[model samples]
Target: MTEVFSSNSELVLQRSVDINLSDSGSRHEDIRELYQISETCAFITSNNYKKVALQFPDELLVDCVAVSAALEKETNAKTYILGDTTYGSCCVDEVAAEHVGADCIVHYGRSCLSPSRRLPLMYVFGKRPINVQECAAAFRELYPDQESHVIILYDVTYSHAIDDLQRLLGDTYPNVVFSVLRADHSHGHACEPFKVRTNSDCQDDTFVHKFGRRFTLTNFMMTWNRCSFCSFNPDTSTGRAESININKALMKRYYAIERAKDASVVGILVGTLGVANYLNIIEQLKESIRKVGKKSYMFAMGKINVPKLANFLEIDVYVLVACPENSLLDSGEFYRPVVTPFEMETACNKHREWSGEYITDFQDLLPGGSSHVDFTESDHSTNDDTTDVSLITGALRSSCLRSSPEPTDGSSSSSSVVVRNQTLTMANTNAAASFLSGRSWQGLERKLGEAPVVKAVEGKRGIAIAYEEEGTERKDSACPDHKNLNYRKQSGV
Candidate 1:
């Protein structure tokens, strides 16, 4: 194919591996330990599962067969290895497992630890080596103050080393706490125990429990539960690492929330189908947008990308309902800003208070969850018209809601009326309809019976670059009206 058609070509599918395995006794033992074969066998045998699915990411597919054989030998159950998940590999592929009628799933590799509502789940986080002494020393260097309140969070690959890290730094830093991962979920309550780690016996009032972690701050007068989140980034030049400041990221999300508030049309991007309570969250978002006098459109385009979301030109903002790991989409590449469910709630819910605590999991926004703030549907009825300057466009932002005139029966319509900045007219509460009304193209006209039906016929015969007739025409005729005749004859332009 020519260079012009190269853009239409597709790359060959190939599985790449970074791990090197050798034939040795120690390597076999390491495989069993890394994949958690022993514990998985016990769980499958105890549950009496006839068929189980072993899910793996692309990078880990090399050992899927070995892991499956080991499990089958020990548990006497048929195993299926599932790869290339429909969505993020972090969440359980329940839909794929259900196709095989799997009694349960043993999810391998990294995970978001989201609850599985349909099928039982078991997570086998493949172990990765981590130097305990190095991690402890880095912790001390970053936090010179021994009394600094810190809650260390790690990837699932480093989970096996968390205990060693905690033990090494326990006596030195009493305030430092390390998170532990829960592996077994044979029972229905797969995600309950992992919600938050707090000490009920501690009488100190300075500590706050949120985001599934508990810690305290020395000063409490800055803001309400204001916490700073940081992560370690390896410095290749110095052969050292430094903590990345997440405060800037938090500020950007807050800016996104403001942009969402100013938006007239909101798009809810469903990034996960296997996550629990996803449908409920989508509906909740639609209702919340309606209550706040904004319009919402739900989209289920799998694996979001720039071009896919760019096709919908009407959406001013998007709220992605995805796993915790994939929830915070970098909207810098997108045409519009993308916010998480928590940011959506804060922008729409009048009763919700912004305390600067970021929540990535949508479950935390649902009732009975940790971050479910105290609010009711009735709170939306009361009009708290307010105006402020937008941080994004530097324009006046208004939330002036009004109701239509009372009917002759002395009853009021429940629909709320909102003011638009451009029109300055009493518009309908539905922002979608109002947005479409202002657009130049309003889709195909529905003149139904008035218009005559037409039959389909072929038109263009070749690609847009060169049509059939244009390509078959004589070279001399092709340049009949060209400004540069000599150039056209040489290059056939």
Candidate 2:
């Protein structure tokens, strides 16, 4: 039996491995340079910041203590290390930093580049080695046309090689562009607001400064794929650039929007507590859902997973409000379809048309945001008589609903029943409530006075791990002094 259990079990115990640390001066210098410890110290001393918070993602937590110690020693200012983030690594945990009364935050590792509202932020993009010449050659080969308008964006890790690649690629491709690293800017929120500009050559080619860089809206926009080029083995000849099929991903997102349109209950999943304007977006989403005559439920959770979401059987779809990088959840494994705020907006507004521009950030959905579009609210009274074919289930679905009709006989109360073909039918306007009512298991049932009551009796004592029975003798008895007490009583003392 033990062998069988062991064979069928999936758990595997991993052996611990010891890593040797080098205390060499060169190694220490590299650490300081890579994390920009000197620059951070300068910023702290110049600003006279008393309390500084150092936020690092899970992967770079190994150097959290070292980085904090170096900063404290250099700046002579108290430093707090924020190892675990409440949301994601990209957005600054202003709430956590506020707990420590930190005036400034120095974020490490890859960030979603979302602007912080509370405290000023400094980004330290650790350098990752890359051969610029080789990357340039690869780019040229992939985009053979010298006139191709390409915007090259990269991960923060490979930010060091961007400038070099820009110079190399710029000489060949006139329209080629590169994204500036966020670390190049002092603070995100402190930077200037987004400005709209147009190029002289192409008046239609608009320019918007965002994500710590200026980008031109041209024919082709190249976004950096996390699994794409930049991370390559120096020894392998397979090359650096790995092409990702973006169209397929967009199609899946569009399908999710269609599914959202058919849903009767929309669950708004609050995935971030740190990002700015999250509360505003949540309220807006609730209003939008109400306007569409659909039910909306808000879920406040730490981390999102399949099982956690599957627990809510009532929710037909979920709209995740999170940072741009983490908002687009691939819901292939989830029981219900998970979509972004942008998709939800499109789904709620029947008049809105998708311009093929996928927005991952909830911030953009807010009023005065870049992706915000003005649309007239649909009249639910008129919509009650309208119906549409569901793109998902291929069933006819109601558009919206108005208030229940007044009693035909001018009575205050009315019956929610209709007689059709000599049979009575219940008219349920609330689709979600009706669906829950039809479920076999409608939660725990309190059958009051159904089962007969039994007399109370002494139950087994002790903890669950080792319960004691009435017949079992406890060696360590509580009355160990019983013999002495009996002798004293016999002596009449």
Candidate 3:
């Protein structure tokens, strides 16, 4: 059974199956309903090529399938599947197109006889262009303010078009701010400077140093929003200056420590970013350390250009500071210490104060004209036993002190050595604790042999303890009570 209706009306199909095919009355009713729905909808073979072969009494399916395919090819220049199988056998695709009131079904398939001759098929499928235009207009209306600060952050591949886009925007909108950033493989282009430059006149020298050659810009504009933008200035000059000052202060502190110990080797660990500022301080201290017959060793870490500076300074040890997350001094060819910025600062200060006495002596010998006095001569014999006892006791105390060991995971130790001439200065205690357990300096006879005598002295500041080796002395302001060691066994010089 089947029924036919006008294109405007709705058609619903229903089917009931009977176990007894012999029942003619029930079969007739089902056929009638099926026919009525088919008449209105038009059934074509679901297969693409065979669609035209299977047709309804009205042949509307043939026309509808042809029209939809033609429209797809002409407008989108694309092919679309059609027929009962393609549209779920219900002619739904044709029905949707009809509802949208499209006209002209150009059957460009085998039905047209000449398959090679392609024709312009425009109808329902061609509405995509118009719809897309409407959507773009709506988006523009919603985000009118998006044109304030337009930044085009793009990949290297898209970098070529950045200048073009910027120029286009500038010519289109003169008041608008426009900028383009070509992102490295990291996906994050450093845009902090561009953001600041867009809003203010301050130029960011660091940003320029980091990205000048890689950056490109065209005429400026004020109406494009192709990239991320901010209204903040990114000038870090003031911050860099502050960091330099901090580095200098720390350098002075380290100089004092070297002087007190008369140490030939002064290890300076500098952060990558702070290297420039610290180099100057190192130079000044270098001359002073030389006068005391000491050599200065400078180590650089972080993202600093050490080789460049090393070339300028005539230094041999130029180590590239690895990332703190994974650091190792492979062969110790260079001073590759895995230290953070904070630790560097602490070590710098400690080294300086530890060698303060030598610094004072060097200063006393300056051009002001002072008689050279030999401090080790007369005073040495008077305090012999007392200095020896003090040195032995301080060494024993330091040896007895124990700290827990850290897990040995093949990582760099975070320990540092501390020693004051003639005093028990705690060095590498925390560092040792982190690497070992149930251990005291007493058990380490080899280290005891290497341990030098400690010393305590009275300077203008106050009383401080110092560690004394064969020709050097190291002082610790924190342990002033420790006695000074005899000059023979505890001299850094």
Count of backbone clashes, every candidate in sequence: 0, 1, 60
lDDT, model 3: 0.28
Over 1-493, each residue of candidate 1 has an lDDT whose tens digit, in order, gives 1112122233334544454342111354567878878888888888889999889876677788888888988888999989878789878899999999999888876677777788888777666555667666666666667886766665665567777877898999887666666644445324432422547322322232112101111111112234444344222111122223446666777898999989988999988888889998887787677666677788988888776777777899999998877787778878788898999999877678777666777887888888786445443345556677887799997764433335654544443454445768675556566767899988877665665545544465444455556765333465654332121111111
Models 1 onward score TM values of 0.70, 0.71, 0.19
Please give the lDDT score at residue 214 for candidate 1.
15
TM-score of 3: 0.19
lDDT of 1 at 88: 90
Give RMSD (Å) of candidate 3 vs. truth: 34.8
Shift of residue 28 alpha carbon in model 2, Å: 8.8
The residue ranges of model 1 lying beyond 4 angstroms of the native Cα positions read 1-29, 140-149, 182-247, 374-493
Consecutive 10-residue window with the lowest summed lDDT within model 1: 212-221
Q: What is candidate 2's lDDT per residue for 1-493, written digit by digit as tens?
A: 0112112223335443332232111344478888888888988888889899999876676677888889888887899999777887667788889999998998886676676677887777676555666666666666677876555555555666767777887788877556553232555323321221224332233221111111111102222222223222322312343444656666777899899888889999988877789999888777677666688888987788776787777899999998777787678878889988889989876666776676666777788987786545444554454577888789997756434445666654323345444666766476567778999988877666665566544555544343455455344467543221111121111
- Winner on TM-score between 1 and 3 is 1
Which candidate tops lDDT?
A: 1
lDDT of 3 by residue, 59-127 (tens): 233243444443333333222333332211211223323332323122211110111111112111100
Clashing pairs in 1: none
Segments of candidate 3 deviating more than 4 angstroms: 1-147, 151-158, 171-493
